[model samples]
Target: MRNLRQILLEEIPEFKAKGEAFLKGELGKMDFKKVSGGFGVYAHRDGKHFMIRLRILSGVLGKEQLVAICNLAERYAVPMIHLTTRQAIQFHKLSLDNICKVMEEGLEYNLYTRGAGGNYPRNVAMSPLAGLMKEEAFDVVPYAMAANAYFLQRINTYHLPRKLKVSFTSDKADGSQATVQDMGFVATLKDNKPYFKLYLGGGLGRNPRKGIPVDRLLPAEEALYALEAMVQFFTHEGDYEHHHKARVRYIADRMGDEAFVNCFWKYFETAKVKGGLDFSPEMPKYTKVGKTVEINHIAITSQKQEGLYSYYFHPLGGQLDYRLLRKISNLIEPMTDVHVRLSMGEGLYLVHLDGEEVQQVAEALDADNYLLGVEQTRSCIGVPICQMGILESQKALKAIVDYFKAKGNIKKSLPPIYISGCPNSCGVHQIAGIGLVGNKKKIDGVLTGIYDVYMKGKCTVGETHLGELIGEVQEDQLPGFLYDLASKIEATHQSFDQYMEANKEEVEQLLSK
Candidate 1:
């Protein structure tokens, strides 16, 4: 009954021994991929380099960890760090010769990359503001951390039919996009005791799905048990024979919801009897204090804990310079007790700061073009790097941002606009208000990159639906199109959400013209 993860872990030492030979091509690519992927090292599109994704549990990292990551980027990988949507740090443009060194260095800082890339459970995601926000139903960090610890080295969770993503949301802000995960834990309070509403079988990518509720409320303490059973069910029953239909969602779809749950309980019954999953319930440690006062009109920046403040800094296109990151880390680590939280939106959130410290941080970052309302525009690593990309999504995002700034008509609080270089939706285009998925079409008798534009997509409490494709626009025409759309919205609607709700036909008409 050994799972793929257990087998891989047992075989890692053998792969590590061949690392030098693999780098020199004395070994085969297939063998390298098998072992490297199990260790979270992925071959880049160029086939000569690699990318290593680190598992920063729940996107939480200490100052020392940040310094270690920056050091690794400088020494072995790309000069900059790439932040993923799932809140993990990716070190790209690495050589196989250096990857093992990177992995060994990570151990010194207590960071890990194993299971970060494989079908094994990826890094667990949680609301970045879980412990800091006053509006949270309950702080879900403890549960998130516990869940991560449980699955981190467990052989059963290392590999699955496909990647299983787990997220814990503090409240309906749903920053973790729990509804769209393989497993989601939405926090709730039952008679002042913490509980979670369980969601299962949700995912995005080629075949997107919103998870259905498995339990309205499961006692929070039993989360590990439920997860263990769910993992067992997927491990034993999932469609391993077909790679395309390997996700747990496929199983749920084929078996029907009632049947899926029935099958789940059979596994659950066994896991319950086996025991050892139960743990002492310790409440989340952080306390939210004081009222938040906005600084610079950026909603992500706020004052919490009386005099202390929090600031969210977005590195445009999720690229952060290693030296700058190290500088920022040094400045804050010495002065405050705050641990940095990497947001799902691909930004950094620094909490527990005094007014003077906040001012100093802001002044230091004023020159970096650190975006004020970066959530307005997002993009994926596109053409030039990503093997699957059809267009330059990051450059396109920069163009759109510049266009809006020049026009001076677009609101800072505009709905999220996502641009993906392909249908893979790494930029989360499907969940955006204005989404653009990259593709190519014949223009002037030549193939040119373009975007299939979408509108009205949402991933919120009352409304959870993917964006509907409205039209296509040439890459050169996108900035103008966005400018015109912003102007139209400014002239009529109070918000982008309101505009989308009322002007679907009008938008279609605009696109036609």
Candidate 2:
């Protein structure tokens, strides 16, 4: 694993020069993007402000790290601290000068931003509740972190056709969305020993695909061999000429699932023979005990260990209030073993807390909390923030939640929504229950913002599937359509998926309206 000291001395200083040049206009927007992304910094749509993504491996954050993040937000006067669907956190609306400073200072807290973006491996995702889930096969966070450590250093020099995504899930819950990653491992056991069920070639975004099963039982120690093999395979066979056709999913699609699996094994075998790829990684074992608290709320869940609990707090749309977090940090500062993990849906979990600590945090949320709804949705930083964005995805989500929540019909029958400003899938809308992709339509011979509506998409384990494009709705009409569709589902007393199945014609009519 690469240390903070080495990155600070070597990679970061090199990036500083490029950042300086970009600020001075010595580097063009397109030209600077080629270098800035590797450092986790990118030019905003405005080209004046920048955003930096922090590599929070496995989405886990210690108290000290949390403190530093809060401090940095205060120091930078950042209005919002954004938690991503990919389980990473970002600081947006920063000046180019401050972007570089945050990257260097953030490393002091081990919140390294290096290799957080670009055409390299992304942060290794794991179930936010991996260790705490009552039904998990075993803790999977350690192995996920191990994979993260292995990839962290290589991303500095390793070039690829496109980015690689990997994940680990403790059980079938698959909260990490393993079925939609370039690679994934689900915790399992054989003859009373730990093993991993592997999946490969899955991906989201333009031409999204569900991964195929590659191995049923792989020993825990040999997991890294698969990682090494995949890097070798993608680097060797990936298409360099076609920008959009270079992903692993495209390769798998062209070669067929069976052929892809067969070819991967050859690389895996070669990797094992190549040596120096085996190691053991262990999860943290919590040992504090307290009184059991009855779980009556959707946010509060019981951990596998008696007398311990975890609290789910979704700062509506994952745009955590900068002010609220400072207060939350103060509340947890005196607690023990209370760490936070970001959920795949852009929520967060405060785990390893005892009854008293959990209640304290719960009370804090009750006093001043972000509201939730089936429209408790998440979206990418769109428009002025994201250079690739076509619409204001964040604004769209807020309008939906604000419109629906006021109707006083927040229920599970209406599935949570996901919105992507564009088709790039940064919002992961392809796997949402109900999704919207930002688009443009010619209205009265002039361009107008619109959204492509999709329904019945899901991320269920072993049954994951992409959402189908149904129709388009003008941005202004989206909230009304969602409200009408959700009301239809509620009237029929069926879930969103069930309603879509039973009332396909009615659904289409509503979208057309």
Candidate 3:
């Protein structure tokens, strides 16, 4: 059988040479690792694009620091900053020559991009309003930080069979989508004390499934220990011969839940006897901001809370302009306890805005067409960038979105829709209520972009499954196609999920023909 890595090397010889050099540590000023997804590095290459995923511990940062990073990025890298779904900022398209300088600058601000790449645990994500939210059962930010600290610089877990994703949500907001990650922790109270309800083996790829509950409840003190044991168990027992079968889910499936739990407990007991750190250190108490500043040319909406309003700003493609970044930094400068939250759709929210100041930010943001077009749509850097991408999905997404908006009858509250650039589904399109997976189709003797429609239920790595393609629509035909779908949804009076489930056979028959 042809190895996947060999195939990749045959296609991109330059990448292979770099990979060999990378393994030998010949490439200076660059960090390299073979992650579950693929090999990645922190060094810059000529005319090659790089993105830095900066993990921020503090809720706010100094304006000067923001300005400096922006200047450095614009001078040596891409002018725009990409904010990830995980509340981290990714500085994209930087030259390899500037990696050292960028790392040095990051140190001054207490920010680093160490584990953003590679197979290592990437960013540890939590609810943006972890402690401040009224509905929060417990603050999970500390636990997320603990996980990051524990895993950082640990190379053993970095080179795994596949990429790993983890999330924590402290409230009922469901903001973290905890049920669909490799390991998810949902905050809950047990015996009137803080704890987490653990879910494991959830992931999305070619095969999508929702995670199963390995442990229902783990006290805050045991959270880290349990996680460590779980990781160790997977490392020892996970399949290594077949790359596709190497994910944690397969292990859970083969071992069975009871045996998996038993193995986990045995490892936990051993680790406890070793006397390693059990929990993260306590974080400083967050203080409330005193005064609010006005934002101009933006859209501001009131939150469920009386004093708080959510400020929305469109950073195109989730790229933050230095000027805009500086302006946002200055606007919140006066507030003693300001928090900036990154949204999954590449939008940013200043969450704790006072009622009076919402108008100012809204006015400033309104100058640009932040609300217009499908530019707001999310897509992974497909095709030329990702090794796995077979088609270009980002630009196609923009076109699809524009077509629907032009129809003028688009539903105001459609279920979540996502478009995947390729089968890898890095964009998480599979989990969306209405998903479009990219494929090539011959239209009138010409190859054109067409998508396989996946609808109903969630598209997770294991539990949630990818649906049959209901139909294929030409690039320009999306508006009409979706309009018909909307009508069908209305006629059924069922949610998109329910309608798809009830009519699966019919939908599949229509698509196949």
Candidate 4:
């Protein structure tokens, strides 16, 4: 039986054809949810407007596409572009009448918004530094792009048990958070041939689980086939009767590891017989897409590939000023081939730049404080825009940054922190060194906002683990506590993970109480 979302997806073209009348509140409540969510248009909690999420697969976007998004937002919504945890762009507070126009306008730039929401394969993420990073095993962009393109082609028509999350990682050290994905591909080299380590059934949001390894080594050629098999297994075996337990993770949880693995193998063997899908091993090479500028002096993060350097710009909680982005886009327009990657951390990365162009890039971005790194922290857009939001997390993130600055530790190296407005994990709190998910507690008979704390999460090439919850902190108490926590940790250890390993009991006693 087709899911309600798939049924809705099939009818969207017709709804879109009756665009004006449909937008004018002609559809019923259930029909509205189906028609809107199927096309990535979500009603704001207030029900007065909608939000459209764009599918920015592979976390990369071109200047033309960026400008198109800005134009759409400026003309219709609040003129602000939101960057989501999945590395996609979102437009908020848009009216129903303007959604199709915005989506249609985006189509001109080859930017599509379909399958960005609902029970479908959403954006496929990979390490934003894929080909440009020096430490990567090999470029995984080709594979990531191939998977994204393949899925998007079928997303509009395919009915899934629930949303499927997919990811790929080229670098183990900075492993694209692949362990939390429904299906993950980690790059490896075996016998001088590119291969991948496959992981399955990992996810966060109410029930968090790290992906279990399916294979130690899978030939690169079999990637697409393996992906197909996984989807097939999920479609047939996943629990559709209970919406809450429809994800692949729940299915794996219900069946023990041995049973789940055995079932997956059956699908895998069948797919293997069907043969490998088309794949390319070539890496993208950018050779000056635009003009070039000379640089006298400017320091960037690091030189990845001799003569090419990368720098990151953050847009506080992923809310980018469309006007500023346009300026930055124009600034790098000279280096036409330079890749602009939308990082999962909600930052923008300018990659593959000539050493000489660094000064001009820095100067252009410096005027507006865009070069500051405070936005490095991951945060989710909070209430009341998000239907599930429990706290205004972005505001809390700003408070943390301000506290760091006041203590003169703004630039100090601390553990990676992630803030989610609720348990949905939109901020990826599960994998953070120190994670905070907002909640409310009754204090003195009054409900007060607080954050549930998670500590000791780890993500690497071979393993990914969700952090353990220590306790909760009152909203008013968070800044001071975080400062003390950072100071105490800095005094004892070089890294938070190391500190946790050495003083688990002591730390737990200190925080949980």
Best by TM-score: 2
* Per-residue accuracy of model 2 over 1-513 as CA lDDT, tens digit each: 445447454776677788778778898887888888877888888767888998888899888998898888888888677889988889888887677778878877888777788788989999999988888888887788889988876667779988899999987878999988999888888888889888899998888889898655789888899999999999998998998999998889999999998888899999999989897876687788866876576678888888988888887678865677778778777877788898887778888888877888788786444435654687888886888999999999888877876777665567778899999988888888888999898989989999998877888677888998888999999988888877777788887777788888888888887
**Clashes per model (N, Cα, C within 3 A):** 1, 0, 26, 3
TM-score of each: 0.90, 0.96, 0.79, 0.89
Give the distance in Å from residue 174's predicted Cα in candidate 2 to where it truly belongs: 0.9
Task: Write one digit per residue (lDDT tens) for candidate 1, span 36-138.
Answer: 6657787666767777888899999888898888788777647657877888888777777677677766766767777786578778899987877777788
**Alpha-carbon deviation at 103 in model 3, angstroms:** 3.5
The order of the candidates by lDDT, greatest first, is: 2, 1, 4, 3
Query: What lDDT tens digits, residue by residue, belong to model 3 across residues 153-228?
Result: 3623355655566777777655665777778888889778888877777667666656776555777887778667
Q: What is the C-alpha local distance difference test score of candidate 3?
A: 0.61
For model 2, what is the alpha-carbon lDDT of residue 249?
A: 89
lDDT of 4 by residue, 1-513 (tens): 134334434555665654444456666545566666667877776766678888887888876787777677767755567888787888888766677677766666766677788888878899988877777777898898888877866766768888898999998864467877898898888878898887788888889888888755888877888788888999999887887789998978999777887888789889878875747657676564332444433235554566666767766677766687778777877774675787787777787776666666776775544223333677888787777689989889888878878877764435768899999999999888889999998989999999998987777867567888988888877877777766777788567677777877776566554
lDDT of each: 0.76, 0.83, 0.61, 0.76
